[model samples]
Target chain A: MILSDLVERFGHHPLGIGQEIGRMVTTPGLDNPPLNITEKELTRGLRYVAVEAPSGIRGRMGVLGPLVEQAEAAIVVKNADYAFGCSGCARANIQLIYMLRRKKIPTLEIEYPKTREEAKVMVKRVVDFLRGLGGTNG
Target chain B: MARIAQISCGTEWSGIQDLLEKAANMVGAELFFPEVDLESIDKAVEEVGVNAQSPNLRLMTARAKAVVDGAPAEAVLLLTCFRCAEGVITKHAIRRYLQEKTKIPLVMYSFTEKPKLGELLIRLEALVTLAEKKALLARERQEGITLGIDSGSSTTKAVVMMDNEIIGTGWTPTTTVLDSAEKVKREALEQAKLNGRDIEGIGVTGYGRFLLKEKMSVDLVQEELTVVSKGTAFLANRQRGEAMVIDIGGLDNKVMTLLNGVPDNFTMGGVCAGSSGRFLELAAARLGVDVPTLGKLALRGDPERVKMDSYCAIFGIQDLVSGLASGVSKEDVAAAACRSVARQVFETQLQEIDLRQPIIEVGGTSLVDGLVKEMGEILNADIVVPRFPQFGGAVGAALLVSGVV
Candidate 1:
């Protein structure tokens, strides 16, 4: 399913339920549905050839490295709240983020809270972003 | 008469034979030993294949054909030693073969001491006469005087030439490039035994050249491309067309296209220190090898690079540390660093520039053997590193001063 569809179905809450699930589920070690991604698709998406980066900052920053390798295509993730909130991780992700932005990757950073308890509200935010709910935000 | 072939050694697909040949010609030596591989002798200084024949006489018989075909009697190979001085010579056993095979005398001249271009030319002139080639010396004819200055982000280089004869050259950090230019100009004048008033004109080029010229005066300021093309042509000392000029400075990188002594087009990278001079320096530090020796170590590695994901200097360093902790071969890691830098340069900056012909790489980074090899492998193009690649821009500026630009 398209990320937008998933975002609209559960992203309407301010608790960021949809955004948190997206992060946790997409993370390599985390348990999530949609584990059927193919080897070819993974190879196509492989930008970071070396998986030496530690899981935290390196993982998020490295996310773009592999994407850049594959056709230099744009990969948009909605995490506006995380964008402003992530502190030390910012340094690691800054260059990749800037490169993605400068390359005009159609990026949409959606805001979500850090704690899992805020899930309901975060879901609403994701839904709002996915549905093009606000004129100025889009 | 002694015949010598001068060649500059680096770890790469090809040796800087032309640079050495030019040096030999400068010293009035007519004979040169064809390059040889010294791989079997594991005890030999690591990767000393090209150096064995440079500044050393190879077997005379191997060069008999060249001698019969009008090559010089003594082949004096020139080399810039990473461990020692600018030039070092290792006499190869080929000298015996040369003496046995041909009637011509063979000799090698290694300059361990740093000598400016003017001093080098005078020594060459004297050596030519000493080799009893007065007639050849008279007919050799020196090229005109040309001056080139590259005001790089970190270093400033100046090369002077007169009638194809490199007269004098100088290099210093960009932080003090203006001062270095002034100091080197004076030094060149002193070495040439000519007053500053003797200079008919001067030309400046490079990223910081514009800013430098504002503080210091010059007769001309050609763009980086034109000066680089002219400098490469001068180093070739003959027809140099359809060549790529890669100038790696401390902060930025430039790739230029030369079509018959003129710059046709060019590309430049961002002013980031990540994939340029600073990157090499940082990697070398991380590896604990001196920057100059970094290339030779890298030449020892197999094909696969260290496989670091990020090209950024900071993350790359961290990755290098982690790789070393995991027992990755230092040489492989170094080679990988070179590959990473080369990939960025070609893919992002020189992507559109043609890589069909052998590329003549200039600038400070050109001195690195590993980067040269990795660049060739990645680009799948023949790469030629001139003997004094660092001075290409400076020499081009000097050429402009002589009206060649």
Candidate 2:
């Protein structure tokens, strides 16, 4: 069974889940296996997908690891949490851009929503980014 | 038949190495007491086995247990009790572990007191008899006689029992703990009219046990608390539950907690004659009076009130002299000294733990009527003083010898 499945079955509270996960990872044995999934493993499972993120340093770094291991198009998702230019999320978005650029993967970035209409527009950008990757799944 | 081992650390007189040798001398029993880390103990046991390849050995805390030729044995753990200020043994745990692991009859002797050479020989005889099949059976069926001795800083005491009728008790001033101990032991035996040969087993308790061990010899040496707790529990005829046992001595103070019929947490102060029985002695010297009469004089105060803040024995005396010049009644001054001692003891014991009611105060110091009365008021609780608080430790030691039966 997956590590997340085990955590879900046993972890009833948020602190409990966090404590269990911390202990599980810290134990001497049972660290590797079907539980440790990589970007290449995700590529084999997914035919069409969008890696959405906010534009910044963190975003650019986030996609770098996955793009280096597997070719995939990226789409940055934005919500009101990033309003007024979030420095933390922006750093993550910048990492994702650097990752796709280094690996020659197709990518796109979009602004987060200010209203309900803007949120719909952000979803459409993610769909269009996946279509440009020569994918089929909406 | 399961094999057993008993590894002892030291004798009442000797250190760790000598104790190891004593354990090694047992017939058909394996013995191991390590000088260093326990990782080497398992290997040492194998090399010294009956067939030179026996694999039944278990290394435990401060001692070892093992099986030799399908027989079980154990080692004793000796520790000092912080509260009662005596050395005691965790003997039963060692015995039970050996019995459970190797399925052999296991026992242990915790060294606490020094016994005379004659007493040591009797204990050795008891051990051999315990291991021997027929003698062990007979001793168990008949119930053996055990004696206890408590050598204090100021006095030496002995408690004797045939099977537990409180046969006789002995007490004498301890010039040197070991020397006084020898005299007390002789006196107790004389009182009981039992020769060393008639004694089944002997246990020693108190701080002076080591000094006595160096002089003479004994079987088991254990802490004062185990001896005192058992004895006090028996005398009181009820389990002393979470109650603070205050032992106010001539030169020092001791406080112990009897939690769930066991003496667990406790504390002790060094030689401070001012806040103990010594305070009364000093007061008696200053007034040119005796100790017993000092208490009654303290009760005869017309004012019935004197305040002496200094707890230092010498400084408090100076304060008392100043108060006397200032027209403080001698009775009130005496009462003030009592209050000083009581306050010091309470600050040391009651400040930390919740002292359960009905505190049992022991020691010759407790005989002071004014002290006991003032302490009762200060504590706002009932204080129970035994008939003879001075002999409590010796009585406790004697009670220890007969407990397991």
Candidate 3:
């Protein structure tokens, strides 16, 4: 959940906290999921998820499709957990981050805080980013 | 009367089912492949209650359990590929759980994409022999001791056996095949407290088996694969019914499938040192630690700290350095390196093979605790490290000449 309260406190709309695009893709007949997905949706999803390289499985791209479509701006927090057993999740997150960058949307990518000092830096960076996006609080 | 139920990856099952059934018939055993449906998987998952990270592995574990529980087989065989990291990690848990639940022996074999059919046939024959007999071949004590030598790329090992028991074993780093063979022989002789003239025959095997045979005038010379399969089967003894043999040497890695008491199919690593003992040595050197201590240091680190994807030695080192620079702990880096090598072995060497339970790991690299743990975790099965793991090749070589005059 990326700073939804903080972004809202600054008077800009924050997409729902803890919202995942994967849920929309997996669940059929969702109202806000990627629209007009056809039989070749699996292949189209792979085109976005496998932007860096061809992956063996494209099932993960279903999550990325709706996520990319729904987001106006994105904040990606990484390194909070290791990607040992969850390479698919990491790959999806990375693909989404890359897609946001390519779309030229206001994007912020930050590493998870490892120390108290780093935590302060993270908050400051988020606050600055929100203000730059025309938030009133800063 | 030994009925065996074999569970393999769906893809691998299609390729070797006929050959496997033929081998089973040859051994006087009936082999059955249980249907691994979603219902069985769900039931297994509910019973196990442990969440395996990979859905494929979760399903496999569940299916294996369901088969053992429902099938009329006396033993279970699990076939796994190298690319399935989840299988390696959960192999032990599955084996123990199933054995406790079903009271049946379980065997696992990891295979490569292209396995040697000849070697597979030999192993299958051995497994059938073991299953039929339910014990290793019994031999009366013979006069004079035989020396067995395994001349590998990185280490030379020698074993001296008297009256079907190992009297002494010795190993040292390889300089030349002949020199290392002689050095190990001398050490074994000294340990056995026997004179040089007491040695009646010398058997040789390994990558330099031919060289050692030519240099030392050996009495019996067998292929390294044959000796290793024999040695693992011998060491496992009755446990051979459910045992899978994995030998990770300096330059090569071998995986053998045992059904009942026989070795059925086997696979070996390619020319790359990416998954061999040399890879660990280099990674340890880069970390300023010895290879033997790599496992201990890794156990001390959090296994979930960082996962490295690269299996190439060069790329692995680069990943290690990058991980360290990124503030990953030293122990975690060490663990990641070990894990990476283990993963590489599974991906490159054992990708197409079926892995089963009670895996027996031998060879010089088996001495490392971290590698074993990593492999065990990846396979999720019981790992058996026999006494003198590194001497298995030598012991098998020696056994060939045990009854010889």
Docking class of 2: incorrect
Per-residue accuracy of model 3 over B1-405 as CA lDDT, tens digit each? 577777565435437666666766765677776656776676675455434555666676776676656766656766656444444434434554575576454555555565555444444544444444333223223235898999888899998988778898889999977888888999999999996789888888876876876677778766566567667666766333556788988987887766653454456666567888888888788778899888788877764666554678788677777877878887887788778777767655553345767788989888888889998887777688887888988987787666444
Q: Which segments of candidate 3 are over 4 A away from where they belong? A: A1-138, B1-144
TM-score (0 to 1) for chain A, all models?
0.33, 0.42, 0.61
Interface RMSD of 1: 18.9
Candidate 3 C-alpha error for residue A122, in Å: 60
Q: Considering just chain B, what TM-score does every model have? A: 0.62, 0.62, 0.66
Better of 1 and 3 by DockQ: 3
DockQ metric for all predictions: 0.01, 0.01, 0.02
Kindly list the per-residue Cα lDDT of model 1 for residues B1-405, writing each as its tens digit: 345454333412234344445654654465345433443233222222222323222232223334434554433333333332111212222222233454442223333234344334433433343345323212222245545677766787776666766777777776666777787676666666677666666778776666667987676665565566667766765334467678877887877665555544454565566669888899899888876788888888753545476778888777777777878888877877777788667545553344537578888888898988888876667788877788877876776566522
Instruction: Name the candidate, 2 or 3, with the larger DockQ value.
Output: 3
Candidate 1 chain A, which ten residues in sequence have the lowest lDDT sum? Answer: A44-53
> Which candidate comes out best when scored by lDDT?
3
Q: Which candidate is the best by DockQ?
A: 3
